[model samples]
Every structure is written in structure tokens, then in C-alpha cells.
Target: MEIDSKDGIERKLNMAQQSDFNDPVISEHNIYVCHVPVNSAFYRVIFPTSKINPYTNKWLKARFKKAVRMLEMRLPQDADSASFDAKKAKYIASQQQSTSKTSFVMDRLLAYEDIFIGQSHSFDAAFEYAISNIYLCPMMGSFEMRHLQAGLQNLQCDEAIHADTDSEFTESESETDDDPSPLRVRFVRPENEFQKKRREESVTLRNKVAEHSSWISLDLEKSTMKSASAKLNSLFSLPNPVDSLLKLRDAEHLVEETIVGNKLAELNLEDRHSLISFKEVRRLPDALQLKALFIKVGVISMQHIEELISFKIEHNLLISRIREYAHLVRGVWVIKSELAFPEDEYSLQRIVRDFALCLLNANLPVRRSDMQLAFGLTVEDFDFSLTTFGEHITSGERTWRLRIDGDETFGKTKEDLRVLIEEKRYWNRRWEEIHHYLSTIKNKSDFTVQKTFKRSFSY
Candidate 1:
């Protein structure tokens, strides 16, 4: 076959087309071979259109025309079998070496065609042309190729079955769309005996707390309240003992006042003053104490001091332990200082900013009142100072926290503050536990003494 000439190429193509059905290869498997010269232009035209279809004795066609167009673009004039084999080996090795299951499955699926369309007219050229394109799978051994094809067929069958089931379900859902009633399933676990009892006790405790708010302090521990309520219920055999406890508390208060009065009369002036100071400080609430401290030291505005110290007192409640020369404002005592305020507005603003930052860095929320007390700033001056450093802080409901975004310094400081706060909380919890244990022990000791005294009297 002189394939160099156009006439000879045409003759070769015609022979391939005429023997398409009669040839053993074409009859059995629709395999058509069209021999063409290496440099012939007719090779491209003959290769794609000359192949016979297996099911129908017609021209073979590509399922994806886009893929065929791309393949045409990549087709090389001269094929290199060595280069093609090397590339194929590399591809197979990559598929085998893949660690990801998804990639391996995809690679296997790509290794063979689902439908057999016989061999390509130019195997080396086709392989070389599509080697770099990942969408195209390289040819594999006959046995592996056959296995992949079978697997693909099974997969297709499963998918078709699943698609039919889905269609049926969708149709049923459309039918139900018109119905007003909806079906719902709720999964619940029935409570056991212990859970039921616990739930009932919780309800009872809540009811008692709601009914008798005056009998017990709201700040009392939940466990302590529970135990006290249980004891009261068991001892008196009453559903509610709050009224009895309230009357007992009033009587105890009277007796305590009488004893304190007698002790005050017996003590000397210095000791009496000390006793009175201790009692006054103990009686003062935390909010009142903070106000007294601010007022006495003149940390707040002078205008606000008089209004803050509303409580009438005959003498100052001096706490010498807090400060040696603490000021006495009305009845409240606070730290005395001859400290000078900064004359410059900039300096005063700087002080407020520094203090606020320190609080934020410690993971403590900044309150306006605390800032005013710390810096001796009036409402106007405090607001002005806050406005000056507004970008660094974010406001909460009644407090402020550091805004760490975009600022490296604040970000690192916040992280460190978080760790410090966590450690402090851990220690605080430990201290609370120890205090609770000591309180329990003291209570047990007092009960034992009372029991012993009663037994002695009975004997």
C-alpha cells in the first residue's frame, strides 16, 4: 500500500469501508483497521469515520463530541510508542500509589471505557495525544480493563434502580403536599424512679423558695437551703415551716441585741468604739462600702459626695486598719491622701486611659463609677476621656472590654489575661470549697455541744 499518494489513501479507506461487515475482525467485534502513511493528511479523516459500530453495522460515533474535538486538537502527526508506554506506566503507578480512596476509585473508573468500541486506528498516536489530559484514562491490560467494565456496568444498574426509587418517593411527596395533616415522630425516654423523685423535689424546692422569700436569704447556697428545708420538714412534720422560722429569727435578733448592749456598756471607750466600728463595717453592704470609700477619700466629684453619704451618724466610722490618716466624711471613713491632681487636661486624660487599659488587660470589665473613683474625674471629664480613647474599647451593657481586633498588643494581652483569669477562678473555687467544709464542721460541732448539754441535763 503506497499511502504517500492521495489516490492510495483513498483506496485504503474504501477497502476498510467495503470490508466493514465481511471481514472477520469487523463482523465479530466491529474492529476496522485503516492503514495510512505516517505523514498523510487523510489519516485524521479516515481514523474517526472508518470504524464500524458493533450493535449496528454503521459508522462508530463518540458519546462525548466535546471530548472527540479535544482529542482531535491534541492528535500528534507521528506517534512514539516508548513515550506513550512510559506515560501510561506513570499514570498507573500514580493511581496505585494514591492514598485517598476517592481518587483511587475515580482513577480506576477512568482507566477503562464502559462500552467497548473496538481499538483506535492509531493506538500510539491516541495515547500520546491524550496522556497529559487527566480526563482521559490511559489504556490498561486486557484483564483489568474487562474487570473495570463489569464494575461500571453493575454501578450503572444500581444507580438506575436508585433513581427509579427516588422518582417514586418524589411523586408520593407531591401527592401529600395537598393534605392538611402532617405526620410527625417524637422519640422520648421515660424517666426512671430516681429521676422522677429528683424532678418532684426540685419542683417542691422551687415552690417553697417562691412562697417564702423572706425566710431565707437569696444568696444562700442551693445545697444548704435544700438540707435546711428537708430538716424543717422532717422535724416539725409540716409541709411549710417558714412562718415558724421567721418568728424564731425575730426572737433571736432581740436576744442578740440585748447581749450586744450589755457588752458595749461593760467595755471601755476605746474598746467600745472598736466594737462599734467592726459592727458598722459588717452591717454595711458592698455597694454602700464602695460609696463610703469614694466619698471619704474625695475620689468622686465634691458635688456628689453629700448626696452619696445619706446615712445619718453621730460619729465617724473610722477603719484605722485600712489607712492611718483616713478621712471621715459624715459617718463613712475612707483613705486620706494629700495627692495632687494633674493640672494639665492631657495628663488627666492619660491617667484615665491608662487605668481603663489596666482593668481591661486584667480581664476585668471597666465600670464608669469605678473609673470615676480611681481617677477623681467628674461625669463630663470621664466622658471626654472615654471619647479620646474610644477606639481601643468596646462598650457593654454597663461596662467596657478591650477591643483586640487589628491590634497585636491587645490580642496578646487578652490571651494572657484569659489564662490568668482562669487560674484565679480555679483558686477562688478551691477557697470557696474549703470555706464551705469549715462551715460544715463548725455546724456539726455546735450541734454536738447542744446534744451533749441536753443529755447531761436529762441524766
Candidate 2:
């Protein structure tokens, strides 16, 4: 299908007509394809519509390239064909309601947690970590378990002490029934059993440290403890107790790291697959099924949102960014077009930079071609201009590099001009001046008088 260059968006083909195979006649613009009745297309592709700002056409082009790359990668769980099919089916059937490729991928990952979460490949290191770490005491190892048991015992002791104190107070009140003054209460606090146990463990750990002198001391004859009770032997070893402890600690840490690392690797693999799957992704049923799973699991993070939207800048945000670019382009055009013919190249370059980069924060660097495209300028518009914005010396035969002394033509340096432009009050007064001048000219008949007044005003 043809699109008129004049208006880029106008469809030249009849929408009712279809190709011989009954496929929709896909209309191609500069870098995007728009299928008629987009929702039912093989894959829903976002195209630049009349509603989208012209300045954002570049962004759409970039998104199209990213989406294509996403369509090329393979899924992570390619081997488990049966399981994959079953999971997909269950996801589809269970949805009365629910959403997106990203959501589907995340749900599958959650369901198959064993692939990413359970076992550590580095068993020796992880086991060593578990045995030695003080923090892992509550969860594992003989010494740490003993410490936890002691803590519980301490809690029980505190409750018993409170009960005894209450009983004594009751007895004393009964013996002196008529005494109105509150009975002086002084009960000795017991030594904390948890602290005592901790101190004992600390002393033992310190004593073990003394035996080793260094943390890296390993038993050279590893064959001595090669039994099912190897772990028990490590716990009771007198010399270099810390070595055994550190190994246990390392094992525990390794387990945790392995779980997290494996999960991340699988997730990354799946995410890559999701990108590829985007090409054939069917909406409605599949999206709804995934959404349902996400809702069921209450997975409502920004990452989930990003996954759903394919991490492209959202429409509103894109429009906002584009609007800033367009405004800068418009402001520059307005300022330049009103100036006298044969303005200095340095001044134009400075003004364009100040308008486009400093104020707008353009996503891409401002270039001559971009500036031309932004305003749809023709060769005639630049007839009197020396360069796209200003003159710059050509580097070798290939590149245009601005010379150090390129701005010698201007009264002020680029930095000085930028500072002046950045002042809010300066722009406000300029805006008011322009407003007053524009307010005076109601029709073409007033232009002659207005031009005279404007020349005198010297803006």
C-alpha cells in the first residue's frame, strides 16, 4: 500500500480490498508497517498514527528495530516440550480473567522454581559455609542449634522469674493487709542465659582460632575424614575449629548464591526467549491467562509493568519527550525566521544549541539532518545559511569538526551566551516583548507600521 510523501500518514490504498490470499494489505511507512485492523494482525505492531507527534517518528523507528531483535531469540525451556505444553494449556484454561508476554514468562518461571531455586551446584563450598557461619546458627550446625536452644531456655527463665515476683508481692500484701504505702519491691535480675551461651560459643570459636593461626589452614590429609560422618568429625575437630566452621559457612553462602544465580540465569534466558516469542504472540487468551496467573500470585512490581509493555517508553512519556523537542525546534525556527537575512553562523549555532540541548534535553544528539527533519526545511530555507546551523571546518575528507576559533565571529563565547539564555527572567522578559509586539499586529495592513516599531525596539 502507498503512503503519500506529502502527509506521510494518509493511506492511498482502499481499506476494504485484501490481497489474493485474503491477508490484510500491510501499509509500510518510512520504517514501520501498519496492518489494517491492527488488533487481528499476526502480531499487533504499534505504528505512528496522525495522533502521534511528527517529532516522535524517530522514536517509533527505533522501537521497531528493538521489537524485531526481541522476535529473534529462542525460549529458555526448549527441551521440556511436554511440560511446557501442559503449563501453557493450564495457563490458558484457568483464566476467566488476567495479560502480556512478560507476564506469561514470569508465571512460568515461578511455577518451575525447582529449575532456579532448590539445589546448589557448589555443594562442598556451600556445606562449609553452613557449618562455620555464626549467623547460620539458628538454622543449622550443632553449635548454633545449641545456641538457639539456649535462647529459648532463656525466654522460659524470664517468664518463671516474673511469675515468682508476682507471687512474692501477693504474699507480702496479704501479711501486711492494712499497710497503705506501696510495698518496696526489689527483685534481683538473673544472668541472661542466651548471653552466657553466646559467650561460651565465642570463647570456643576464639580458642579454635588460636589453634589455626590463619583462616585458610586446611587438613592436608583429606582422606582421614572420608566417611558419611565427615560433617560430625568437622564439628568436633579441636585444632583449627574455625577452618571447619568457615567451610560450613562458605557452604551455606554458596547454596544461597547458587540458588539466586541459577534463578537469575534462567530468568535472563526466559526473558530473551520472551523477546523472540513476541513475533508470534497472540493476544486475548494467552495474555489473559498470564494476567490471571500474575493476579493470583499478586506480582505487581514495576518490573512486571515493564515486562508487559516490553520496556519501551510508554506513549504518554514518549509524547512528552517529543513535545519538548518540538517546542525547541519551533522556538528556534520562530527566532531565526524573524531575524534579518545573513545572520552570523556562530550566532545561529549558539542559539540552536541553547534551544535544543540546554532546554529540551533531546534524547539523541542534535544534528543538521535531525534539525532539517524536525522542521521539514527545504534547500530554499537554507539558501543564505553557510552550514546546517553554523560554519565548521571539515576534518580530513570525511567529517565536519568545529575549529577552536569557530566562534570568533560572536560577541560572547558559547558559555557566556548559555548562561544568559539559562536565566529565567531573561526569557520571561523576551516572551513579554514578543507578546506585546504580536499583540499590536492584528492584520496584514498593520505589518508595515509594526515592522518599523519592531526595528526601533531592537529585540
Candidate 3:
């Protein structure tokens, strides 16, 4: 696979990682690989390194293809747009009915949940974060739990409550002054049955807190569960009510912390294991990416579709997370509406290319070397200069320059100097559409471009 030194995308790759500026004259052999650092919180939570199959990797790449199609379906042609299509919506709904990954989702969530509740390990990814977190509440991250537990430990406060001093806030108008009075009012105990019952519950709650504190902590290796429980019972006695209440509250806080901590820890552990299962991914055309590129795209059979789903599961955490929680998680991530990607080998190849280019639009500029490493260019007739359109526009009420890359780049001259000088955004929506088109082409077989990339441009 070789990309010509004149390719703009390749040029961008050359200068991006190696230099501080855009060095436009690309050399044939100067290829570059773009690596997005995984240390960021988003990447850490979103997509971590995983052992994925190469074939399945292609399906993950289909998300890019889907990105293109989603744009195409909603927007006007080549104008960077999207729209509502009731018919298309119905078609997507039909596809969702056929593609269900619920079993896999359930399996992964429970495994992770078990680990999370155990209170160990950090998380690299979270499949169903909201649901998982909500489910573990009262066990973790429950402010109410923390508050109640902390309150129970204040045995001195409880004794004070028994001592007949309580405060209330009241706003009153003073007879002698025009200004209202805002002061805390201290009141003596009423000595009523209601107050006595309230006082009793508070004491009981404090006791329960101590009983559960460190329930799972310690001595597992030193003693059996029965022995540990016996020891805990003996250790739990207090000299008086105050000491008892305080211990109970401390124990409650500890229990609350431990439970939540364990659950969070387990989620991280499972997510890490899932990443371990991810394989090296390559982009493939998915049904959604397909429908966006062309209406009458090539035929994709059920077998290939399965392969695509596998690719998505392995390389794409977004897809994997969905599949991991299929039991509770539904609705395609808007990118999985793959119903029309070309299924032919030649078309799949192009689809792969288009998908990669679509990623470029996302600031993930791929080099020709990447193309070779990924999927080689199949369209030998691709003339870079002719496939784009360059122009300027006013954005944010300010005059700006813009250049758009079209599909065919036919009969195009050199980069338009006027468009280049005036436009800040020079790429075209067609590039996204076309990039998806190229990816669709690559999904069929192992074909690649022969031109090498130059290292003098920025995407």
C-alpha cells in the first residue's frame, strides 16, 4: 500500500507528530501514526486497550462509516447537514429488532458488579455507568447514608437530646422594632411520648450502625466467619448508651464506605478485564455507515453482518459497552443503524477508507501509512485535488475562509489560494461522505493503496 507524497491527509500526518507547523511538501516514505493518549479521563472511561480480533476490528471501524451516513441521512447533499426521514426511521427500527446482544450485556455487567462491590481495583472502562451506579446506591455514593451514619456516632449529641436542650429556627416580628427578628430558639424537652419514641429510634439506629461496621473487614484469614461474628458481638458492648451510640455510628459510616468502595472497585476490575479481551481493531463498513454513503450500496449478507458486530464489540468500547449491558441497555448508539453498507469486497474497501477519513474530520487524521496498516486505497482513480471544494464563509458574524473537499475532485486546479487564505475550515462534508464510501469499499477484502504518504501537512 502506497500513498502519493502529494496527498493532503498524509502531509498533515507528517507535520502533526514530528513538527510544530504544517510542512506541506510530503515525502513518499515519511509515514506517521497518530496515537490518542489514553491517560485522559474520557478515554480511560470510554475506550481502553483491549484484545480484539483483527476481523472484528473492522466492524468497530464501521462506527466511522456510520458517522458519515448519519450525517448524510439528516443533512442536504454535501452541505454538512442532517434531516428527519420518517421512512428511514422506520427502516432503522426494523433493523434494531433483528440485532439484539442482550445476553452478552447481562453477563458482563454482573461480573463487573461483583468485582465493584468487593472494594478493590481501579476501573478502566464502565459499560453501564448510570444504571450500575444507581443500583449500588445506599451502598455507595449515598449522601443520605453518610449523613445518617455520621449522625448515629454522635452519642454525646444523643445524650444532650435526652438532657432537654433542642434548637429551632423561627422568623418573628419584634413589637418594639420595624425589622424582623431571625434567631435560633432554644426549647426545653416536652417530655411527651412522641419525643421519647423518637429518642429511642435514634439510639437503636446508632446501635445497628456499630453492629454492621467492619462486618466484612478483618480476620477472614485469621478466623472463620462464625468466630469473627462471635468476636464482633463480644467487642460491641458499651459502658453506657453514649459509648454504644458513638460506636454504632462509626461502624455505620465504615460499612457505608466499604460497600460503596467495593462496588466501585469491582466495576473498574470488570471493565479492565473486558479491555483485556479486546483485540487489535481495523475499520469495516457497517450497515449504518453503508446507508449513509449510497442508497443502493452493495449486498451484505448475514454472515458479514455478524462479523461486523464482533468487530464493534472488540475494538469499539461504545459498541462493546452496549453489547456488554444488552439486558438493560437498548437503542443503537445512533451509529449502529447500519442497514445499507455495501457488502461487496470492492465496495467494502472504499467504505473502510471513507470511514478513516471521517475520523479525520473528528481531528483523528490518519496517514497513508495508516491506510496501508488499516486498509489500502482501492480507488486508483482517486485524484485528491479534484475530490474537494474550497471556499470561505462568514461564521459567528465574522468573515472567515473555508475550503471544502468534494468527492471526485475532477478537473480541479491547485489548492485555491483565496479559499486557503480566507477560510478557517477548509475541508468539505463530501470528504466525510466519501471517506465513509471508501470504508465501505475496504470491508469486502484485503486490498490496500500503493502510494506512500508525505509528512508535510495537517488535517
Q: Which candidate is the best by TM-score?
A: 1
Q: Name the lDDT value of residue 368 in candidate 1.
A: 81
Better of 1 and 2 by lDDT: 1
Candidate 1's TM-score reads: 0.15
| Top of the candidates by lDDT | 1
In candidate 2, what are the lDDT values of residues 1-459, reduced to their tens digit?
454343345666655464555656564333222112211212211222323232222111111111111111111232244333333333323431323345655655433211111111121211223233321111111111000111112222245544554554445335544444687755487558897799899989865655454222112222334652564344333334566466565554444443423233333211212221221121223323233222222112223333543235754453233222122221221112212222354344333333333222222333446445533345444322323233333354322221111222221545434433443344455445544543553444468878989999996
lDDT tens readout by residue for model 3, 100-176: 35586443322211000111123323222342221111111111100011111222323434454322101111222
TM-score of each: 0.15, 0.14, 0.14
Note the Cα lDDT for every prediction shown: 0.38, 0.33, 0.30
Question: Model 2 segments beyond 4 Å from truth?
Answer: 1-144, 149-459
lDDT of model 3 at position 178: 39
Runs of candidate 1 exceeding 4 Å displacement: 1-319, 322-379, 382-459
Query: For residues 148-250, what per-residue lDDT tens digits would candidate 1 score against the true structure?
Result: 2222222222455445545544453354454447777454987789988998999898666544542211222233478756642443232235765655556
Instruction: Report residue 347 deviation for candidate 1 (angstroms).
Output: 6.4
